[model samples]
Target: MENILHSPINNNTLSDFISAKDYTVSGNEFSIKIDEQTGLLITTPRPKAEDLGKYYESDDYISHTDGNKSLFEKIYNWIRNYSLKKKLALVESKHPKGALLDIGCGTGAFLSVCKQAGWKVKGVEPGAKASALAKEKVQESIYPSLFDAELNGQKFDVITMWHVLEHMPDLNATIERLKELLTPTGVLIIAVPNYNSYDALHYGKYWAAYDVPRHLYHFSQQSVKQLFGNHEFELKETKPMIFDSFYVSLLSEQNKCGRKKWFSAFLMGLESNIKAQQTGEYSSLIYILNRK
Candidate 1:
């Protein structure tokens, strides 16, 4: 029943290095092991879900925020929403107006947008507060967990797990479930951080995306393609999330050097994007996949 693989990258919780008052400040140490052949990085001795209690419910989980936001927060949200709209446009282009399911649908932001765009939408969120917030936004019930029996027989044209696949420990089981939930011609969109990106190499172990035990898997482009290929998924397209380089680099700067060097981080992000543009190794990648 062991799901873990080989090789390792030592990392710590963001709170351990960054002076962030918003997030729960636990500096617990952990190592992420890599499977050289598969290019998969696994957090060694995965921390139990319960042991990582309430980490998602912290002040840092801004998706669950209610009411008006600060100017900065609003700007950030605008950027995120704009990015999501573009992402949805890509998905819609492939499978125009079909039943869509968003896994890890926090606050139902994307779900709400999809609904407005005329797609039948459903969401699954594991976080209590986030689920409640999502329910308020979407007409459909937001299931609290991925294992809920309600999703057993349901099928969808699109199943998206944005930046969520890495959080899962049961790789084989998760892939199987995604396949089962897809319609005959369905698409599965999985977005994950790329450990092979220049920013990752720049930040090294201090890469903020390596959120220790919470992010059980650190997937490179090769590893992601390998994981899906192993499970009979044909990667249709590889889309880059351009903003992630800036966001992750800023966080990595904060985490690695114990300060927010915005200019330096911006330069690093720009460089990362340049490298990714030339080499196709983005900081974060959206893999559009279909059953082979």
Candidate 2:
């Protein structure tokens, strides 16, 4: 198990070092590469958190309620509206009804929804407080670490990593382990920010989705597909979560220069939505993949 890095282009930056086609690190059956174009790290076999501090930033984590009341209300309404559509789509899809696992199930909001839908739900989360909150909300056991969690040999019919993959230290290994945990014909759903989206083009590094350090890997559709294809997974479907671009852009603008730029944030969000609707390149995309 050697971690090998590969990139089509090379430079002196760490991003370049990781992305160099010849660069590879070996330890636990994983390799990480940096994409020079996007400045994102890609890994074969996901990385593990030796200590919580490396990944967890208290200030960055948003509560269920945080931003302005209007913005909060709008976001909640959007989430609620989209959740129904997403849940319906999931139910109608080929996904099985057996056990489901949600990796990095933040606050367990999605799990709670799934539970109400009558699916057997379980999760893995790293944040202690968020994990506790998820437990309270879903009343299901949540492992604090994906590396240490016991799967109990129960294969899952559906595994979701909503907005979680970019945060993974070793992306490939995580997906590999997930493949092992999935039942035959099982589906893995992943949602991540799309660096190729129009918002990214306009915002550059200011793009809200690149919640840097926390978002170690900013993936484009091509990169994500390539990552999964190299492994044994086949992409079943790819679609953008259009609204996220607007919301995330707002947050990103607020974080820029250490103060909230309300007008600029709103304008960027508006522009993101317009472009997302016109083109399918939303700020984020949700991919449904099946094991090949």
Candidate 3:
């Protein structure tokens, strides 16, 4: 099955140039094609794998993977202070209290923050090592896969997908399922890399956010809103999560041309910060959405 959809443009600034193409995998529907012009995924209900290896245990953290108490402490502190702050802000703004779910909750960083803030938290993660680490760090029950987890008929006030939505092959179905799991006034928080950001334009295919086959879909702000709109969700607010630009750009610059460009990476990091403050279209974005 195939569907061709209009490309998503940035607030009608540029002509639509991207096209979206949907495909299927093992009887599950998913999108695999993205038009560079409009930056939209054509398919709606696509199939995706639930494999955990695709996201957990990066090469950078392999050395500190185990028995590195000091290293883990440092990492925990950094994430707790920074990443968790942004995530909490989103949750506090919308839900304030009640149960919360974090899909693809790597390392349970955000969950720790939520727990500290007194919100009941649960998560679904596929990565074994990461899930184990998360279990140790947060002490909360985490399901290995969202599809396999039984919610015990419990509903949540908020569902978060930080940088996890793009990895999904069945974007539409996933959204629908999340809707069913939500309370009538529940909110869903989604954060993903924005392909239409200035950094993406500057870096082109070298953009780090385009993590190849792993990032099944590249979404722009407009495209994401449209996706949610079709699924009976309302776009409550959108904000650029600027920190990822520097982090992703650093990785991209280091891996540029198969060589680590430390200096170039530093420059990219600086550039990302400047662009984020000025334009509010950083390399990544957080979307706060509510069911209609």
TM-score of each: 0.89, 0.78, 0.77
lDDT of each residue in 95-161, candidate 3, tens digit only: 7698999998877878888988899999887777778887887898888776764874768999999
Worst 10-residue lDDT window, candidate 3: 20-29
Cα RMSD to the true fold for all candidates:
4.9, 7.0, 6.4
Candidate 1 residues lying further than 4 Å off, grouped into runs, are 1-24, 66-72
Clashes of each: 3, 15, 13
lDDT of 2 by residue, 1-292 (tens): 2233453223224332222111111212223446755455554323344542443545345532223356556565667557746854674476646688888887777787788877899989878778898899999989887666577576888888888888776666787788878897888888898766776777655555655444556687777777787688899888777667667766666545555576776777678767777777778888889888
Best by TM-score: 1
lDDT of 1 at 213: 59
Clashing pairs in 1: 7-33, 7-34, 8-33
Give all candidates' CA lDDT scores.
0.78, 0.67, 0.68
Q: In model 3, where do residues sit more than 4 Å from their true spots? A: 1-32, 35-38, 41-80, 276-278
Off by over 4 Å in 2: 1-48, 51-55, 63-88, 277-279
How far residue 149's Cα lies from its native spot in candidate 2, in Å, is 4.3
